[model samples]
Target: MHEVKKDGILFHRFDHLGHCDRLCHGVFTRQGGVSAPPFDSLNVADGLGDAPAHVRENRQRILRATGGTDLMWMRQVHGTRVHIAEKGAATGTPVADALITAIPGLLLVVQVADCQPVLLYDPRRHIAAGVHSGWKGSVANILGRTVAGMISEFGCRPADILAGIGPSLGPCCAEFRHYQTELPEAFRSYKGPRSHFDFWAISVDQLCRAGLQKDNIEVQKVCTRCHDDRYFSYRAEKITGRFAAVIGLSPPQPT
Candidate 1:
């Protein structure tokens, strides 16, 4: 991910998906906004009890910077339920962890502080999905279900899908005790005694097992907890803000 600065707004872009002119997606950092400390700048999530007005303004700033409207955000219960984006459907703040869509211009977003924001896109079917996969969500295999949902609903071939795993708490910073054991036993083969678990690798493995071509997957190696200066990290700061990973089909060209 390369940091981009224009018009006093700071954000980053995925190099692997750079070829997709039909898509406009970015994983934003915690910079270029009007919020105060803790929330800092560009905190997209209203989850931290920030003023609603401030959140709205920050959201507007992002939409303006990205040329997107009406961000299709979810309540994000960290479950595997996936929803198809609808333009006119009554969105009752669905409890799904993932949102899939072939519908253009309906930007799908997932908020995260230390959790992974996974974006899935099937260029062949013009389908896109945004998933919020934290430790619980990962153990529940939300990543696999998201890919499966995109295939089942939009007829997206796993081979044709491109997935990106955005910044989050890396294994270096994601520590858990053996007794409580938040991660499942399947991760034991990939674990170490004192070594923290790597959710990024777990997500990639899940995508691969779901039939997505390994070459089509891109993982941003940046660790949110390690780079607290650039991103917001819940692990780094007990009460912090969240950055957003957003994706949607490009709008039609004007005649």
Candidate 2:
């Protein structure tokens, strides 16, 4: 992943998708905003007890940094629902954990605190999706489902899609004490030292199962819980804000 700084704002981009001239994508950090403590700066989720005004400002900063026209995201219920965000299809934020879209200039966002945010794009089909894959969502393979949706809904091939797994709770801090009941039996193998789980590997495996080439997937090893100074972490701070992982197809360039 390439770290980018624009003005005073900073964010990260996947190397696989970095040279794309028609893609606007970023995994933003908690910096360069106008919010107060707890939600201090760069918090994009308004529903998480942050002032709507601050959230709006923070979101605007992201838009300015990426030069994306508009941003849209779901309510993110940690479910497997994959909502299509094509132009003029529907209004309001849908209650889903993932958003798929082919609309140019519209950014698809996945807001997260500790949950993994996955950004995917099919350069061949000009389609993109943002996925919110928490432990529950990952157990259910929401990321795989999103890739499947892109294939069925937008005629996108998984092999042509580039994926980026953003910062989240790493194997070091993802301690699940009651994994025997909480996590499914399959997750036992991904356990790190103690009870921690390597969700990054799980996501990569999910993408591979969905037929995406391993070379097209970029995983940022930075853990949100471990690097709470750069990112917001729900486990580290019970009352914190959610940062955004955004992806969109830029408007067509003049030939």
Candidate 3:
């Protein structure tokens, strides 16, 4: 991931996605904005107890940095439901966990504290998707559903899609408690006795199982919980801020 700073906002780009040309996407850090305390700097989740005005100002900073003001943000219920965001259909709706669209310039954002924010793009179909994959969403296979939705609704082939798994809680910090049967037996294949989970690996498996080529997937090595100086982790800090994984179609170049 390449970090680009513009107007105090930090935007991290996946090397696999190339430059800020046709496809634009960024994993925002907690470096720049005005929220103060726990939500200090660049918190985008408005309903998460952050003041509405502060959240609004923070969102404006992101919009200014990425040139996407009319960004579509999900309500993030941590479900497998994948909602398609058309040009105007996303303006005001019930919060959803994941969003998919072929609409150009309409940035699709997913807010995450400890959950993995997965970004998918089908260059062949000119479609993109943003998914919030927590343990629940992973158990429900939301990542796979995002790909399937793209294929079903937009004729997007999984092979041509490039995916980026943004920073989240890694196995090092994802410890589950006893008496917790929230995870199904299938998760046993990915977890060990240590009780920690490798969410990134799970996401990779889901993407591959959905038919995306292994080489096309880019996973950011950063762990939010471990790198608290650069990101916010819910597990690390009970009261933490939220970061955004924003993706949108780039404007056409001048002919």
Give the best candidate by lDDT.
Answer: 2
lDDT of 1: 0.82
TM-score to native of every candidate shown: 0.95, 0.97, 0.94
Compared with the true structure, all predictions reach lDDT values of 0.82, 0.90, 0.83
Q: Output candidate 3 Cα RMSD.
A: 1.8
Residue 4, candidate 1: Cα error in Å is: 2.7
Clashing residue pair totals per candidate (backbone < 3 A): 0, 0, 2
Q: What is the per-residue lDDT of model 1 for residues 130-213, given as tens digits with 9 covering 90 to 100?
A: 999998888899988888888777788999999888989887877777524566678876564586787778888999999998
> What is the descending TM-score order?
2, 1, 3
**Model 3 vs. true fold: TM:** 0.94
Q: In candidate 3, residue 188 scores what lDDT?
A: 74
Tens digit per residue, CA lDDT, model 2, 15-95: 988888789998999888888889977899887788899999899889878867888868988888999996796468999
lDDT of 2 at 237: 92
What is the RMSD of candidate 1?
1.6
- Candidate 1's C-alpha runs over 4 A off are 90-92, 193-195
Error of 3 at 3 (Å): 1.5
